[model samples]
Target chain A: MLTIENLHAQVEGKQILNGIDLDVKAGEVHAIMGPNGSGKSTLSSVIAGHQDYEVTKGNMLFQGEDLAKLSPEERAHKGIFLSFQYPVEIPGVSVTNFIKTSINASRKAKGMEDMTANLMLKKIREKSSLLEIDSRFLSRSLNEGFSGGEKKRNEIFQMAMLEPKLSILDETDSGLDIDALKIVANGVNKLRSNDNAIIVITHYQRLLEYIVPDFVHVIFDGKTVKSGTKDLAIELEEKGYDWIKEMV
Target chain B: MEFKEKLLDSHLAFEERIDLSDAIHQTRLESLKTFEQKGFPSRKDEAWKYTSLNAMVLKDYALFPQTETTIQLKKVKKYFLYEIDTYKVVFIDGVYSPFLSDTTHDGLDVCLMSAALSKAKYRSLIDTYFNKIINKEDSLTALNTAYAQEGAYVYIPKSVVAEKPIEIIHFSTGKEKALWLQPRNLIVVDQNAQVQILERHQSLKEHVVVTNSVTEIYAHQDAFVDYYKIQNDLSTASLIDNTYISQEKKSNVRVHTFSLGGKLTRNNLNFCLNGQHCHSTLKGVTLLEDQQHVDHYTLVDHASPKCESHQDYKGVFSEGSKGVFNGKIHVDQLAQKTNAFQQNNNILLDDKATVNTKPQLEIFADDVKCSHGCTVGQMDEDALFYMRSRGIPKKEAKALMTYAFANNVLESVELPILKKRINKLIAKKLGVNLGFDL
Candidate 1:
């Protein structure tokens, strides 16, 4: 579903992702485990076409098309979703309105008619119920005054609504409690299909227990230093990142 | 002659048309003398530092229309709030247009200022609330009072709620080569009465038209009044609006001013809390592009105990447009436990766009709670990117953010149709097609 070869990137002239190479097929979950400042978030941002990050070298291909030429919204139109670590607090736009706008915008870009109001509402209700979100929560301003757990759940709820082909969960477990972590992981598990892929970016292996990844890659400094099965996450959890730093 | 000198020279000709023996005529004579002494405010004046009337004062303008012109309802119907029923007091080229007006005097008096001034039955009301609240020291207000012959007059007696909202519209039909107009309005909401008024100034064609308007509102004890001013005129139009509001015990008064388009516009809004527990709210939203200019000067005077006031104004300027916001809050020595809050925020879309915001507070009461804030900034790039990443294009994203930034003010509008109209205006001014209604 997605391929990145030696993806070198930087922000504000400071190199962050020196060279990241990753590949994932449909129905596969890849976990990029790294400590703080390991460019995990930068890689996701680059994939989502964040204007702040400049790809210094290499290329990213989504469905055989280069992503560097696409804008953030264009990339989104091509079905790439990035769950932000810290969602912005837009005080006036309600969650329902925001999601409706997003859905219609993507649909418009694809030359499709806007989703009927009834269909949109039905989808919102279904997805929100899947994530255990209250109907009242969807009427409130987007992410404003939301608790840490609520924010993460809302991100997953947005993911459910978008139904993207490739989704990047960037540190989705950092701020969630165990119950919320289960809910988010379960939601992702339900959305997973043979036509889609998922990249789970995290610092701890605790999340791997919930939605086990097919391949676990250890990223340090910038590039991947080790790639193994899900057992690598358990080993790293027990040994800690200090051994991985020494190996680098 | 220059417009200022022409105004000073036209006073005698104006007085010849009105009754000289009336008591209001004497007030007009005094105001004309004051305007003659203070001519036009120069840039050196502290209050007029950022706005200069030099260019406008130099133009030659006809004080009155050369010939009366009639307009079909089809031509200017879109300017009215046609979504709902309203009592309209409309004027064309500073002259009252009875054909286009929907006035009533049944339960409440929703009529014209000229009738209230000339008729003997309304003499007492004309005497009591005519110039009671306006500041005599303001030269522009005094100039409007000197030529205060026409506008809207609304009176709700004690315990009576006006059945319908009043719409005061002034349309310039481009009958004269260049025109100068002064419209006067008086609204008296007696004790326990309630009223809502919407005022707008429009120019039908691309001709120079300047409207110097003054409105005085008196809210007695337990009265409620809502006033809205919509200034979206043609590029050749300019407006100077002076509105004075006086509130008594337990009264509530709110003024919302929307300045969307104009060559130059100035709003002088003042509120005086004369009794305890009065509430005053002043809000404004300004959007300008090109060389358009808008200035909002508001003052809230907390004179009695337990009074409260809130002032909020937002502005978006693009290109070479200029915006100015001056909010002043004053708490008298006896106004203990008074609460006052003022906030002004501006977004400059281009490097050349300019905004000057000033919050002036003078508190003499030791037990008062007063706070003020002012900010001028560009749109948040991070927020923009967040929206864009969600598949909303940059233009639509920017427009949505701007709408959200200005939406909070519209949320408080008591009239839903007016709110919807202003929302559409904001969206149109931003020039973007949103997926959903704003």
Candidate 2:
């Protein structure tokens, strides 16, 4: 569902991602793990088509469509989702309204009519409950004065609403408690199907315990140094990135 | 003759038509002298530096309209807050339209200024409140005073609450080729009284019309007053409004101005806190496009101790539009423990748009809290990116941000229907039909 070859990216004259290669098929979960400043989050931003990150070399293709020429919104309309590490707090826009707008905007881009109000309300209620969120929280301004756990849960709620084909979770578990992590993981797990893919980017192996990836890759100095199965996550969790740095 | 000379020439004919023996006549004569000395403000004046009226003064206008044009109620009903009951004082072509007005005299006065000035019962009110709070040095205010004879007159008796809101509407028909109007208003809320008023000036057609209006409001001990001004007219019309408000002990007053469309608009809103523990709120939302100009000059004078004032103004300018905001907060020596804050924020949607914002704070009191700041720029790029990445296109994202930027001021509106109408106006102005309200 997604392919990248030697993806080289930089932001504002400074290099972040260099010589990165990755390929993922449908119905699989990929976990990219690294230490601080190891370009784990940069990979997610690059895939999401953030304007500040300019791809200097190589290309990214999603379902055989080159994403380099597409805008962030265009990428989104093509079923791509990136959960931000630090979501922007927008005042005066309620969470339900924000999610509804996002859903309808995507539908409109696909030449589809808007979902009826009753259906939208039902979907919001069902998805908000899946994340263990109170219905009252949906009416507050989007992420305004929200706690870390609430913001993360709300981001997952939006993901559940949009139902993208390729989902990128960047540092999603950093701000969540154990229960919230389980709920978020369960929500993402339920949305996984035969025609979709998931990429979980994190700094630690703690999140892998909940969402169990099919493959694990360690990125160091903007390059994927090693590709292994789930046991590599446990070993890295115990011994730390020193061995990985030495191997690189 | 020039427009200024025409005004000075027509005042003689207007003087011969009224009862010159009244005390207000003396005020008119003195004000006429003041207007004669100071003429119209030039670009050299410090307050008029950013806003120029050179071209406006060069154009000719009929000082007095020739006909009394009456408009049908069905034609102007949409402009009113029809969802709720209101007492209306409607005017057309600077003349009162009795057929369209719904006034009251049972324990309150919601009627015409001319009747208030001439009647024996409203004599004390006219003597006590009329033309008392306006600045003596303002030349345009002086011009309005020299020709002030018609407008809305509202008086709420002591401890009495006005049963319904009042609507002061002025509609001008393009009967004259080029017309000018000056209307005066006086409102007095006695001790512990309460009232809400909405004022608007609308032109029916695309013609040259200028309105120089003045309004004075007095709030006695423990009284409350909520005043709203809606300035949305055709590009051919211009307005200059001078509003003065005085509050006594424990009184609360709020004034909101909405400037959506006009060729040129100037709002001089001033407030004086005369007694202790008084509160004043001044808020405005201005959206302009296509060579429009709107200037807001506000002043809050804290004369007594333990008084507070809050001023917030926001604007969105697009496509060769211009906006100006000059706010001043003064704290007297005796006014200790005074809290005052002012904020002016603006967004320019086009490279040709311009905004000049200045905040002046003069503090003399030993213990006071005063803070003022202003910001002028485009929309936030990061916020835009965030919304756009959520599947909203660039245009819709920009509109949503702009709407949210100016939406907070409407949250404080007490009337839901009026707030909804203003919301629709703002959405229409942004030219975006969002899936949901922002």
Task: Point out where model 2 deviates above 4 Å.
Answer: none
The two-chain DockQ for each candidate, comma-separated, is 0.75, 0.70
Q: Candidate 2: global Cα-lDDT?
A: 0.90
Model 2 chain B: lowest-lDDT 10 consecutive positions: B429-438
Q: Model 2, range A58-93, lDDT digits (tens) per residue?
A: 889999999999888999999999888988888888
Best by lDDT: 1
- Candidate 2: Cα lDDT at B389: 80
Tell me the lDDT of candidate 1: 0.91
lDDT of each: 0.91, 0.90
Model 1 has a clash total of 0
So what's the TM-score on candidate 1? 0.99
How good is chain A of candidate 2, measured by TM-score? 0.98
